[model samples]
Target: MILAVDVGGTNIRTALIASHGGTVQELRSRVSLGDRGVSENDLIEKLSALFSEIISSHNDISAIGIGFPGFFSAGSGILLSSPNLPQLHNVDLAGRLSEAVSLPVSMQNDALCAAIGEHRFGAGKGHANLLHITLGTGIGGGLILNGVPYTGESGMAMEFGHLRVAGSDLPRSCGCGGSGCVEAYASATAVSAQYFERSGIQTDAGDIYERACKGDKHAKEIIESAGHCLGMAIAQAIKLLDIHTVTISGGFAGAWPLLHPAIIKSLDTELIPPLKGKTTVLRSTLDDTAGLLGAAALIN
Candidate 1:
């Protein structure tokens, strides 16, 4: 049994996982942190407390795997930066947690972990090369090349969201300080911001999606714009890597009905003839549990 934790900007999800033939049995999902903002110390304490609770009830845990959203040193488990969770920069989070929990900890970028989970047990199963994208408050990506997870020299490869794309007239900037990045227009935050700006309604991406589902033309337009931008970015990635399988997942991807048409349309419009009909863009089957399963896969 493995303890898997997925730490995101909005929540920290932890679960115990048992894998059996490409299927993962999740014991239960516990949210240690909700939408509340917390300091580094507070976050660490929450993690430690959560682990202690799990340990008190279970035994024979092999290792702890953490799927953290940020740039970190793969060797040292030192988080360098997290645009969303800025308070965690330069913190040796794994080291701290290991001392507290008395368990060896392995940390990985959240998106990369998602990709690994998908490749081993979810949407990208049976595919040797594919891209896994998480679309939420921000956009994140991970790549599998020749049946291996491909994190570059510094463990910072497959940063697809930060890649420049055609800029939108809407005033927006990415967390990475770029204006033309795909995330600037395609992320959940971006979509909600665009909607708020246009409609003067303050709501989250999910609410906007609900409005779209009710046939709100303005909401649909906002979502379609985001989808078109995201699809264009995917086209560039396919052209560059020549990888056909792409999996889209995350909290915001639940709006697939609103995004799929525009994405397919843009892909058809942008991809070259040779790439046409060869690519497959899939929705994640693992859902939110992908990160936890992925974190457990790291230990194995």
Candidate 2:
């Protein structure tokens, strides 16, 4: 069995997977790193304790795999930087975690892991070329080309969220210090922020989606706008890569009932004549478990 770990800003989720790709056990714990600043040592200690708790009970585990939310030296497993966990910058996370647990460890970007999971076992299965987009607090993307994961030279190939979709006339600011990025409009954070700006009520993306479901015009419009921007970005990508199959997964993807129409409309309007109506966007079947299965696949 391989132990798969998915580390996020708010939680660390772990699971045991069989060699043939089935989940054996799963566990989750709060990161508890509050508003106060976090340190590398604190994060490592927290992860170590969690791994220890699981390892003590599962004697069949052979190796460990991690899906981390950051940029890293793909060959070395040394994290370069993480917008969410900056304290761990330049740390050899895989090496440290391996030492803490005395097991071989492999790591990859969380979104890339999700793509691998989907390509191997989920919606993207059987596709030689696929694009996977995750719409969460921020947007992330992964690509599969000719039956393999492609991370580019710097291990940051598919930074789809940062793609500039808006012109200079109407710039939208993004947390990455850029303007006009698709993520500025299409992320869950963007959805909630847009709703609060127009409604003066602070709520999450899910609640806004529920309001849209109830025929709230303002909420509906906000989500449609997000979907339109997302479609625009996808059109640009498809034009460049000529990949027709796209899979979307994340918390906000549950609102597909509302987002799909706008996305398809935008795609129809934006795509070139020959490429029009050729794209297929699929929802992930593995849901949250994609990342776990992907992490396990790394070591398997």
Candidate 3:
């Protein structure tokens, strides 16, 4: 059994997993992660308490793995920079968790973890190459190439949200300080903002979708624009990697009904023949457990 923990910006979920021919056990529990006002120490304490409780029941866990949100040094487990959880900077999360739980600890970015989970048991199953994109509080991505998670020079391989897109203002900055990155237009926050800006509607993506379903032209336009932007970014990725199975996860996947058509349309328009219908975009099959399950796979 492996102890899997997914520490998000505002939530912490834990699961006890037993690998059986690549499928995992599903004893799971979750709790609220602190808001911006929460201190680093508070976050650590909350996680430690949860791990301790779980260890009491699942004492035979072979290892502990965590899916952490932020720019982390894979080798050192040091959180260098995290847009959602700035208080985590310089934190030795793996070291702390290992010490607290008395177990070997492993960690990966949430997107990377989610990708591993999808590749192992979700939508990307049986695919040698896979891409996982999380369009949540911010955009994050992961790539599994040849059945391995390919963290680049510094263990940050698929930071796809940071990639610049066409038809965007160069000076437009993303939450990561980059110019016109995918996150600038593809994230849930971006979608809501666009909806509000385009229509006088002060609503979230859900409301926008509802209105669009009712034939609101402005809502439809906003959805299409976001889909186009997301599609263009994915098209560029395809040009470089030629990955066939791409999975979309997180809050933004809610826009799939509106976004996917545009994404497929844009990709088909850009790709050459023979590769036109090759790539298939999928919605994540895993529910909230995806991240934690993927974290557990680090030890599997």
The window of 10 residues in a row where model 2 has the poorest summed lDDT is: 28-37
Please report the TM-score between candidate 3 and the true structure.
Answer: 0.88
lDDT of 3 by residue, 1-300 (tens): 888888887677777787532455555645787687667778678778888888888768878888887767855666676767766677887888788878888888888999888888888889999988887868888899999888787666788988777875443567776678878877778777877777766787777777888999988887887778778888889989988989998876877888899889988887778678889999998855678778888884
lDDT of 2 by residue, 1-300 (tens): 898888866777888898678653776554544432567777677777778888898898898888988887865778887777756668888888889889898988999988988888899999999899998899999998998888888778899999988544868799989899999998999999989989998999999999999998889999999999999999999999989899998898988998988999999988999999888999898878888888888885
C-alpha TM-score for every candidate: 0.89, 0.94, 0.88
RMSD values for the candidates in order, in angstroms, are 2.6, 1.8, 2.7
Candidate 1 residues lying further than 4 Å off, grouped into runs, are 19-43, 85-92, 167-171
Give the higher-TM-score candidate: 1 or 2: 2
- Cα lDDT tens digits, model 1, 1-300, are 788888887667777786342445555544646434568888789889888888888897767888987777755678787766766678888889999999888888999999988888899999999899999888999998999888777778889988877645654677787678889888989888889889999899999999999998878999998899888999999899998899998888989997988899999988999998788989999988778888888785
Judging by TM-score against the true structure, name the best candidate.
2
Q: lDDT score, residue 206, model 3?
A: 73
Please report the TM-score between candidate 2 and the true structure.
0.94
Candidate order (lDDT): 2, 1, 3
